[model samples]
Target: MSSSAFRTVPASADVVIVGGGVMGVSTAFHLAEAGVRNIVVVERGELGCGSSGKPIGGVRAQFSDPLNIELGNRSLRAYRDFPHRPGADIRLDTVGYLFLLDSDRQVSDFAAGVELQNGLGVPSRVISPDEAGRLCPYVSTDGLVAAVYSPADGHARPGLVVQGYARAAAHAGVTIATHTAVCGIDTAGDRITGVHTDQGRIACSTVICAAGAWSARIGDMVGVDLPVRPVRRQLAFTAPLTPPAPRIPFTIDFSSTAYFHNSDDGLLFGLADPDQEEGFDTTWTPHWLELFRTAARHRAPALADMRTVGGWAGLYEVTPDHNALIGRSAELPGFLYATGFSGHGFLQAPAVGEVMRDLYLEREPFTDISPLGADRFRHGAEIRPEAHVV
Candidate 1:
């Protein structure tokens, strides 16, 4: 749909969502499934126009944090069976996820992580460098002492998943207004009154902040300081190889935080910039390519010969603890949060949708998300950080 159709916002809605990415649409779908259909999803631009569409689509359960592992497990199941549940084929391929370790210290940390992941039924195990090479034949495993491989972890088409949720939500009578920018969140004495969009005002008592990188801005409107900051992450892809490489698992060099995976007979790779400044800046830089080239050559020497085809930049809604902030806000009663997943939001959207829906309906959530609440930061509680976040 074009922006022209969104010239006028509805007078009111039972619930007003601030973003139309995968998280918002999935939340709407789950809410509709739970018999709440009077929902409005307002997107500033097209659905999945943000980080949701730009992720390399890696999904895994090999996490150190217990809650993160649980979220990943549930999301993995949903991705495996999403075609029936959400009625869309996301092209989920469980080739696997392999993390290469360059030192014994990393191996030791990963071993502990594997123990916890296996305890939670993740089936992650440590392997020798030779074994890792066998898993990914092209990767040069030099200077690598160990590796962690989880066969259940994989990648999927992120855009398709978002579209699937949007379709399901629309079918369930959830109104999605694209190109509608939210100007302000109206409140009256600590209670949400409505949302003022660029088009018009929407009289909604409940407002959900699923605005991805812009979540903190939305929080500011309601007098709440959501500790979510936008950080730029860049990815580059190579043209199709001459001899099509074998299906490669999502491989990460844990030391440098550089990773790559198979995509369209080519390779999709990226690196986390250590000097990247916080804020919304999506410019693709040559310095990033240089950093990635060095990392890739050290991990997979063969990749040095492949010419760069194209790439994109996206935002990571990084929190202080590199986790998510979910649940209702104490400052404002009806204001809820479903953002700040760092870079793991796309993979965990399915399970988060269900959890948020349950919380909104005053039912017991499938998993205990108390640790991920905003109050954790305020109360000075110890944050259980996820170790493997590439």
Candidate 2:
């Protein structure tokens, strides 16, 4: 659809989904496909202008937790079938994901994780350093003790995924209101009545918050706690190589949180800065590239000094436990949310969309997502941190 068509916001909708990123669009598509009507997705900027606008997104089911694994695995299947279903290529490259380990403890932990993933049909396994080197020739394998490999796990273009879902949703009668900033939420005796946007007020009985990094503000508007904070994550792309980059797995140095994979004729490098402050700032700083360089000097020496043409910076909507918050509001039944995905939102969008659709329909989802409710933090529940984060 053209930008002109998305400018007008409807006065009323059966469901108002805040944020037009992958999660929002996916939810819109699923709900529309499920026979729900008069759905409107409100976005402050263009669709996928938020975190979902990233260039390449990794899709994997190699998680230490079963819930996360199921979410990833199920979404991977949807992404594989995206071209036929929602109908878009999305550029999914199943080059697989490789996690390089340096310590015996790391190997032991990954072994347990591999066992769990395999039992859940992830096809992930622990391989020796030699096998890891064969999969990704760029790796030095100097300090690498072992590595976890999942051939089905890889990366896809997030922007394309967003467009695919948005197009599908729009074609299904979903009104996608771009450049429509949600200003306030109307409530009455614990029930959400409408959503006030910069364009206009939309009277909606149900509100789904897939607002990504800005979700906490939306939650506050409705007196619901989302506990999501935006943290900046940056990555750089290498200049076109003299000899085109080799086909390699999406490789990661687990200890340093450094990762790299083939992109175009070069490679893309990224690392999580341990000292990064929590905020919504997405300015792509060259300083963080040094962190990736430092790790590469030890893990993959060739990438330590590779030239970078440019890069992209985006936000990771993080929760205290680093797990997603997916549930309906206990106080306000009309409000529902699926955010705080940390860095896994794009990979898990499809499955979470289905969960949100089922939740809105008052039907049990294929997998029990009750444990991921916001109430867990309110009750001080001890949640395990996902170990396979990169």
Which candidate leads in lDDT?
Answer: 2
lDDT tens readout by residue for model 1, 66-158: 898999999999999899997999989899999999888889988999999999999899999999999998678778899999999999988
lDDT of 2 at 290: 89
For residues 165-222, could you state the per-residue lDDT of candidate 2 as single tens digits?
A: 9888888888888888999999989888998988888999999999999999999997
Worst 10 residues of 2 by lDDT: 1-10
Considering summed lDDT, which 10 consecutive residues are worst modelled in model 1?
1-10
Query: Which residue pairs show collisions in model 2?
Result: none
Model 2, residue 127: what's the lDDT?
95
C-alpha RMSD values across all candidates: 1.5, 1.1
Off by over 4 Å in 2: 2-8
| 219: Cα error in model 1, Å | 0.4
Error of 2 at 309 (Å): 0.9
